[model samples]
Target: MNNLLDSFSNFSYRNKNFIFLSFLILPLLWLGIVYLGSLLIFLGHSFFHLDGFTGQIVYEFSFKTLIELFSSPANIDILIRTVALAACVTIGSAIIGFPIAYYMAKFTSPKVKIFLFIAIMLPLWSSYLVRVYSWKLILAKEGIINWFFEKLNLEWLLDTILSTPVIGGPSLSISYIGMFLVFTYIWLPFMILPIQASLERVPNSLINASHDLGANKRQTFYKIILPLALPGIIAGSIFTFSLTLGDYIIPYIIGTSKFFIGQAVYTHQGTAGNIPLAAAFSLVPIVVMVVYIYIAKRMGAFNAL
Candidate 1:
């Protein structure tokens, strides 16, 4: 082992480019064969159609599946619903995470910071399904929330909110509001970490400089802090938005029967056995994320990464 290490070090010193290329080859091959190759195959599947009579996938090239993907009203609604929900989740995560992140970055002692960071991350150590189902119990009609409200003689407030339109439904567990809350809770950590990292990168001198220049707290935050932290905010939003867009489980477990893009893709592929439609449905998030990333890049989000 010592001889092998010495030989490798000598070889690396003598032939740096060769070693670099050698290291690059495996990953490049893996990307080509595994990632890009599979992506190409999946995208190709979207152009094919399913035979109505025999229920077999037709291998020939056709645009019928793609056309139907865009033209179908129900599919369009699902797409819109997914984007809307993802946007809401992203905003909510940002709102809830930013303050905690700011405090950790700016005010907390090292020991307190470590403790708070651990607390933020501890929830993620448990199974995602466990956390989700816990929310399920919490949001149920006879669950802790209702019980708390009942003890306070405010059960009518819960009932009233659940009866409201759009976000509300017959029960909290089956409502859009419940799903949004779960999404916000689940993705909040992703938001906080990035924002904290970004804020930490910001020098205290810059903030002090801003204050010295006669900027108020609001002005300093708006003009100095936010602009610098934009990249991290955008990065966190990318995670939250894309994750929410592709999540079927949270909607299914915590919310109503209304279909999301992820649920539609699962149903089409697993239940309906319609591979082409499933592939096409899966493309929505990919396309959306491509555009989203492009926009984020234009806004300088990639600079932080």
Candidate 2:
């Protein structure tokens, strides 16, 4: 027993190459078991067909589900709309986030920096559902905006928007604005922090040199700061894009319970009870993201942003 204990004690446990590799191996194993294993299970189920007559999976491989997924016009419409919405929201967030992050990096004092950071984070801790619900009330026809208009006797403002085909619509109940607003709110922090890290890495002397060389604010921002922070921006883009693609709950609560890939997967696994088909559909977005990441990396995403 003493010999065994002595042998055990001889094993040095600091993070040497072997120790690091061992740590890495444990996580790799966990990932394989949890993620890849789940995917495989889902894929395996996809081969079995759901027999309508029997109300259970038939032990048969069929292209019926895949064909239906591809051939359906409604599914195609949803995919197109989801893609467009995600793209638009991503652009909006990038435009909005860039200015905020740039200002915070270049202008803010250290004394107020932490406070500003906390202010950005404060909403994240609040209920997502409540945020959506708040928008619901705000966007309603006779809600706060209309109430304000009535109080001011500006009745014309109400008619113009409500009468407009798609500009303002009847209410905010299930508008694209709701999705865009919430998506921007939730993902803004993601965009801010990454860009801030990149901005910090840029040597202060570089910016000072540009100023010393008589470069104006626009020239410094576009030629110096933007290029240096490209990597962070790209990283932020990936986070925002992927999160928007996979989110079901946001649309479910705020929008029209619209069926994006995440909702489709959720429905398949839970309500539709077609785990296999859901798994296959889940890969569509994963594959899309992987390609996007690869393309983004090829554009020097690693070191730029």
Please tell me which predicted candidate would have the highest TM-score against the true structure. 1
User: In model 1, what lDDT does residue 116 have?
Assistant: 97
Residue-level lDDT tens digits of model 1 in 1-305: 99999998998989989898989999999999999999889878999999999999999999989999999899999999999999999999999999998999999999999999999998856678989988988987789998999999998898899889999998888889999999999988988888888888999999999999999999999999988888889988999999999998898788889999999998999989999999999988999999999999898777665
Give the lowest summed-lDDT range of ten residues in model 2.
7-16
For model 2, residues 124-157, the per-residue Cα lDDT tens digits are 6677678767776776776887688889999797
lDDT score, candidate 2: 0.75
Question: Each candidate's TM vs. the true structure?
Answer: 0.91, 0.81
Error of 2 at 141 (Å): 4.1
What TM-score, to 2 decimals, does candidate 1 have? 0.91
Q: Where does model 2 exceed 4 Å of error?
A: 1-6, 12-31, 52-55, 59-63, 141-143, 148-168, 302-305
**TM-score, model 2 to reference:** 0.81
The per-residue C-alpha lDDT of model 1 at residue 128 equals: 87
Superposed on all Cα atoms, model 2 deviates from the true structure by an RMSD in Å of 3.4
- Single out the weakest 10-residue window by summed lDDT for candidate 1: 296-305
User: Using lDDT as the measure, which candidate wins?
Assistant: 1
